[model samples]
Target: MNPCRPEEPPTVGVEEEYFLVHPGSRAVVPASARVVARASAALGEDVAGEFTEFQVEGRTQPCSGARELRAELCRVRTALADAARAEGLRLCASGTPVIADADADVSGDRSGDSTLTYISDHPRYRAGVLQYRSMLDDFAVCAFHAHVHLPDRETAVLTCNHLRPWLPLLVAMSANSPYHRGRDTGYAGWRAVIRSRFPCLGPPPYAASLAEHERLATAMAATEAMLDPGMPFWDVRPNPHLPTLEVRAMDVLPDVADTVALTLLIRALVATAASRAAAGDPGPRTGAELLRAAYWRAARDGWPGHGADPLTGRVLPYAVQAQKLVGHVRPALRAYGDEDEVTAFLDRLASRGPGAERQRARMAAEGRLSAVVDGLVRETCPDR
Candidate 1:
């Protein structure tokens, strides 16, 4: 996560990604006019559009903690769906849609050069086609992005540094990118690898302060690589325009509730880390060691990395890791009145593991690939 670190109060915001599904066939659709029109109306004034024509992002008003984050996510998702449904469109939170071809490039012109579409313009979309021409050599990709506001850039940097180790866990937590272009790709989070094609992406650079981080950003800027801020494309990143930390790793989830829960968790993490930082306490585990641990797990096992501290070279089983994770974060969640949210999310994770695991189970059992795509959204669709 590229951020500024300093001691201060913590602020929170959320950005959620959605797949615009055609209500007629439950297939992916380029959620352009309808998605934007309805979402702009349905979401509060804070909602913003993402780069993808089919994707839209909703942000929270600066929030206090887990409970507030939950409320913010709930309200935003309800409004987003309300807007999407208004035009016979359904919102899907899955990391990757069932049909890789679920969505259409409504712009009819892929002019943009950034994977993070700044707008749906023929020139810009076409610009995107020409850019990232090297990294996108393999596999198709789609993604959802979320952001959390902080009190200041400096504090945002601190939260980012501390949270780096956990970004993979968050991705593992939000593992929804199981399929690739309508096929059951074996990887749990294939998009994670696919998106790494861009320059200066994947994990973040090491820096102690936002100033140094900016220096790095400045250096990258000199290379003329930033077609869009979204193009920097790290898993846990920040938005320069918005006063928030943007978490870009999660595959869009099927259920808005899961997204909500994940938002709550992120808010809790930021709040807790900020609280610790405010009192001169050490913050979350970050840096090269932690980042290495998380990246390896997310790339290999996805969320099940919860079981072992790959960084410490411990091969603890999944059960042990689960206990460790609960032990570490439960107090924070409980303090935020989010124990229930944590529990519900855990149940879903345990039952299905990651989306990739679930997809594999189905595909292996049925010996049919289409079933995997068809059910990806349905399986993870919002639970109530």
Candidate 2:
């Protein structure tokens, strides 16, 4: 779409993964097939099953503004929650299940004598289980992915370099998974920690051009480190099938307002990057190691804590980084008429903390993980 001109904000879409939880026990249940079937009847292909049977995902159509996106997200999430309720389950938007059966075996004939349960009956997922084996044991984490349309693959690849320095800030702002397997992980976004176990996980490497990006993706696929060229597991990358650069660093947020806020911010970040690239500004050349360190810090600390600036490798408080991000993207946000909504969302987050902190607060107040799951289910699909 003309590569994010100042007058034209890039169209964006979001994909959110959710967990199906038993309402009483608060345990993740393998009910995605039934829940997705019912939800798809109402929401069409926008709702679908994820890699694991206990997880489902909802996708929003490309939207030009925050209001449209928020409506679409609410519609899809409501449909899913209704469907899950119909089947005696609750839809949870947390990054990880509050409680899970850790010893539960992968269900599917592809994994040998295991029963036909847990894993979704997909060829790719089956192959993944066969290949990764034990690595897939605790692989039920969910994430929020935002796709911002770019002019072309080349531009998308270039924009990724520009977007790299801010990945940690995004992680800190969107931290939602604070607990895993019924116990507090002591990290804000434990989902990030879970994802890092994969071969090509974490922040993407700097690429001089689209060709370089393709070469690395192809190599990863050839080595069987990834399921395919499309699955790099990087925090950010040029989406293989879409003409958009996707940000996959954030945990799936329970609050719809937070989701809309993050998506708009992502669009602004991409627009700002693309405009700078057009003006002959080469983006930050942050090293891979420094980026990883910064990512780890964000996952551990969330916000209002210590974080490192990937650009200069300078450790700074997350509050400072958050302010810097808002300042950097303010021009683009204003151009898109999204400054007010985004700013308000950020302020609320600063005042009340992100989903991770809220979830932790619930746990502390009720003295049970079930309370955290209940809070997640409630926030996942608030009344319209």
The 10-residue segment with the lowest total lDDT in model 1:
1-10
User: Can you write out model 2's per-residue Cα lDDT over 1-384, one digit (the tens) per residue?
Assistant: 665476688899999999998888889988899999999988898998998989999999999999999999998999999999999999999988889865544443445575456788889888887778778877888999999988477877788899999999898999999998888999999988887777777788888887898889889889888777755767788787788889999999999998998899889889888877766676889988888889889999997678899977899988788778889988889989999888888798889889999998998899999889989988998761
TM-score of each: 0.76, 0.95
* lDDT tens readout by residue for model 1, 63-133: 76556766777777777777777777766665655563423432333445434332444564445556655
Among all candidates shown, the one with the greatest lDDT: 2
Q: What TM-score does model 1 achieve against the real structure?
A: 0.76
For residue 43, model 2's alpha carbon misses the true position, in angstroms, by: 1.1
TM-score attained by model 2: 0.95
